[model samples]
Target: MLYSKQKVAKAVLVLIFFTVVLIGITLVSLNNGRNGTRSLRSFVSEDTSTSPESIDEALQYFIYGAKYLLAAVKSTVSDNSANITAVSHSITVVKDRMQMLLSEFEHHLHRTEILSFLSLPVINNHNFSYIYNREDICSKKAVKLVFVVPSAPGNVEKRQTVRKGSRGDYVRKNANNTILLFFLGKPSPGSNYLSLQTKIDEEVKEFGDIIQADFEDVYSNNRLKSVSMLRWISTYCSTAKFVIRADDDVNITTVEVVSALERAAETLSNFIIGHKLIADRPSRNVKNKYYLSKKEYPPPTFPPYLLGGLLVYPVSTAKLLYQAALRVKPIWLEDVYITGICATKVYIPILSDPGVVFQHRKS
Candidate 1:
């Protein structure tokens, strides 16, 4: 007998939940066990013959948890009036360590690379030895896929409803008609906040594929964002002609973005609309996480920055941007400094729509 599609999806959700839980327990047990803070014998009664599938599942969960934990640490580390020098230095050390772990766990799965061939990538002129996949990067015109990283199955499904079938792929009436808002990654389990994130991610699935993708690193959270982003750019850009990148917190009208982008699809190199700022402060300073040393960027105002909250770039631009980001030093704030710098260096202008973009800076 064949099961209904709903049943199948539900079963998959259950499997994932248990898998994430067991993995979390096991990793916690092992580490705590070694330190003698907690005993591991009690939790080791389960089957030891773990298969590649099980290990892979566990590792992914470990990585997801680490990402959340890292965000938690960075967000909570410094006090309100902390000195920029000391806080900045501490953050730098943590960022360096996180980048190391992220570097170590590079390829858990071929992610963003899955859909890269759409637009013709503009050549990168950075100081580092950057390799451009001329043949595959941004060669395609359009493609379809779901974004699964931001939440759980049920939540992802809801987001898909908002994103999918709403305005139909591309917003404006134009040729190159497909643009998908793909959301991916894992959400923390059994938490009210994560539950909300999962719900939002499900809604995003309607827009594309929300695969249960994760990077396999338990020690560092930066590794997950860094790793997941690398995966997304590598695999996803190949199929999309133009792409939209966003965080779950912000409000995004994909249809409006498509309409706005389509208007300038002919003249623009790349577009990133939203309130953009290039922070002049130092990121290492615990007081201000959105820090960039004045020496690195001397001007009081940002050098044509974009609000990392929402962005729309040609697939080629995404590929080029990610590649350029990899070669540069990883900063504390991932989206702004890394993406803004990469885009600015290569002259990939962050397109903006003043009407839609909103930014509130810390005074």
Candidate 2:
């Protein structure tokens, strides 16, 4: 947040007002001592008639008042100097904070230009290959929409939950127009790898909806999973009018998504929509889970991005974004790298459809 100019001005004015009040009190006290009166009111009300002795006493009072006035002025000046020094320090702190905010704002405002100029990782078609693919799923069927979910090999229960929920029901009801498939990579090699792969093979045999690629399915390789999905869709499901990239944990209202797409059939190509995050600054704290080092992304703020939980875009846009990703370096954050950086490269706008996507919470 920017430091408020009005607040600073008001504070300075208040300090000055208090300084003047202190000076007035000092002068009043000096006057009361000179007249030997309890208060200024009593001194003013005393008799003015004077003899020669009284005149001499009045002259003495003037000399004392002058001396006391000078002393009081000096003390007030000293106090005010200290106050001015404190105010200067405060202003310096506020200035530094404001500069940081402005610097971040500048990065956000011009992110597209910066992303375009930065060097990115380049790759060829062989960067990823499919270990298990079902090209026949889209080749034989006239698919209007496809839902590609990136799943970890160990998340067998989550996959089953999706198959049992509305997503499964929607595909079952409209198999001709819709296709739902889970995208996965090899699980981390461990003692349980064989057991997990065996179960995955069984699920593939039973469901015929899982697509496995030749990459390690670790947290850092999430971007690889998404890029693989894009390449698969563009290669096999190009006829699909719309594609929804969803996380395994999200609960999608497939009915609403279909209805919305049907209503916008005339303008469904080369566009994307989902939950959008705008002008989000990259986390710099090393302890943060989403931290981005300056060496990785020098910019203070990331480009506008859609959340990875749910995203809806035309297959045409997905193809363009995939092409863009081939040249752009992948970031640690998959959502920011794919939807934010790659989408920006291709000039696709990331919008919001709150009613269509919801984060699923176990009740």
Candidate 3:
């Protein structure tokens, strides 16, 4: 079946046109997968007036594009004979852009809502030096107990006195198994306070067990101080088995704390052990120092929380509580906010222990 030359030429031209169209469609699909459906609009709206709805729509498109690109990159990387270097470069660029977009979205949400807690920046310039930072404390031995003592700036002398009088034997006995750190805030700023600063410096030089952050030394900032201390532990002493968040003034029986941790070591990975308060209502009296406004806490009954003066928890529980605190608004009561609310947010259990008593005692 021989055909004329002109007819054969016409058929070849038609085939070429169809092939071009198919290639064009393939390119468009790939571009869409990389930049989403609103890719064109995103570029156009860059210089044009846009509304919130339009920005939201663009965000959705960008998210879709990111997901699609991620899948494509993963698939491409799995192929053994693919151009690995080129694919990796492309993926890095896409990841940077996606991260930038997500950051912008978070900023927008912060502006529109009361999410100040979520925006709390990481504590910077924790001014206190590491007086007794044993980086290998957990690595070298089994750390059964870690006592985090929250102390005031004015209580340095008292702390030293107590350490020498009452805690000396306990410290000596648990030298390898326990760690003790005094948490403090920055000193008051004034010329008259120079002597106090010098005293603190001398004490730190002698003991080297204080952890000071840049926050104010006040009752209301206790929650912040607690969280900051947890952050420090998470950064520096993450391998410890258990922790006791306590006050410098509290009479902590180190023997009791070590025994409890030893007994519960197998079953207590995410539990808080302390004197628990159940079904306690928030105070409403304006004259009371522990007053709670409805705006601050609308819940009728407070979740069961350990007494702030002395609470024991596994290191894992402390880490989870710290993470949840970063996302939740802090209440004035550090015990309720951190152990009850934040722990609840992260699904950590709070258990009552009769041994951890909170009372002032005369040495």
Candidate 4:
């Protein structure tokens, strides 16, 4: 179980900590001669007289040395705090690689148990004809942002709310440079699909911001929705400097996203930033909507992924992810498949940005 692994990891970390402490003390001792202090070797060698004062002096020297050693370690740790953080980040990257390898092995081992679970028929074909696409939105000028929102066809009210909100208004006013498009698939079978499609057509005609694809709008096809968005961006919005994949229910400020992008403009290559989810395991409870059977996903923990609520990356990163998505086995969990698996495949570095806010709408 994961608990045993955590216990072993903690033990290793403790061992490493003690090893560092010993090394610090050794370096401090070796530098005593250069710093005009009595070395421990000299203190022992010179003080050979069997007087009680000599013994007391030796004891006091050792006490002083202990204090000095502690101070050196503390100073070293403090001075190199940034380096320590980088080391921790490197460890996290290594952990992600290990988990990815484990997941791959498990997938191969149980390939036959699942029924076309990872197949990407929609992605491979690349025949995503837009029922209502704003292909000309970014045609005339350079686009600064392409905000992609994936929504269900039934959530018409949600779409309108987002449009009337501040974020949508920002996109609407900056239509020449910024764009917001809703990506959707065909309506579900239980709903009035034709009627809903009619309403969507009307909405798109009025607002010119919908990109309906040629697939079913079901929970299992969530990854396909992302694939479609990427494909669209690659085909039509390649000039965009940045792209965001957010959910319809999530409230995100466009101005804040633009500001974050501004701060990260210098190092935009191979970059993806979002709220990170590390060591999250799939739910096993059947009653839970996010449940996954052992046969579907054999790993104990998922690879680190960004939450599906909001994701920000450059257009170049999106292209790389789309290319990787075609080869990597698809998963129903869109966030894990795109941000975790595909991003890892292409060696795109995902930065954890705590400032990306997500306020989910109530049901």
Among these predictions, the greatest lDDT belongs to 2
Candidate 1 TM-score over all chains jointly: 0.43
* Candidate 3 residue-wise lDDT, 257-354, digit = tens: 65665545443335677888899999999998999898999999899888888888777667766766767776788889988898776556666544
Cα lDDT of model 2 by residue, 104-203, tens digit: 2333333456456434656534367777899888889689889888899988999999888887887787654888899999978899999999999999
Candidate 2, residue 136: Cα displacement in angstroms equals 1.8
Better of 2 and 4 by TM-score: 4
What is the per-residue lDDT of model 1 for residues 264-347, given as tens digits with 9 covering 90 to 100?
A: 444343444555664543444536645556555454554556655556656566666666565544444455554566555444
TM-score of each: 0.43, 0.65, 0.60, 0.66
Expressed as tens digits, the lDDT of each residue in 1-363 for candidate 4 is 011334434533443344344443444443444553655455335553553343234334333444454455444444444444434443333333333323322322233332243344435565757777778778877788888999998889998888887668777675637777899998977658779989998888888889999888899889899999998998888888888777989888767876766555443344577888898998889899888788877888888888888888888777767776777766688888888877766555666654676789887
Any runs in candidate 4 off by more than 4 Å, and if so which?
1-123
Clashing pairs in 2: none
- Please list the residue runs of candidate 2 whose C-alpha ends up more than 4 Å from where it truly belongs after superposition: 1-126, 263-265
Clash number for candidate 4? 0
Sorted on TM-score, best first, the list reads 4, 2, 3, 1
Backbone clashes counted, model 3: 2
Each model's lDDT comes to 0.44, 0.69, 0.63, 0.68
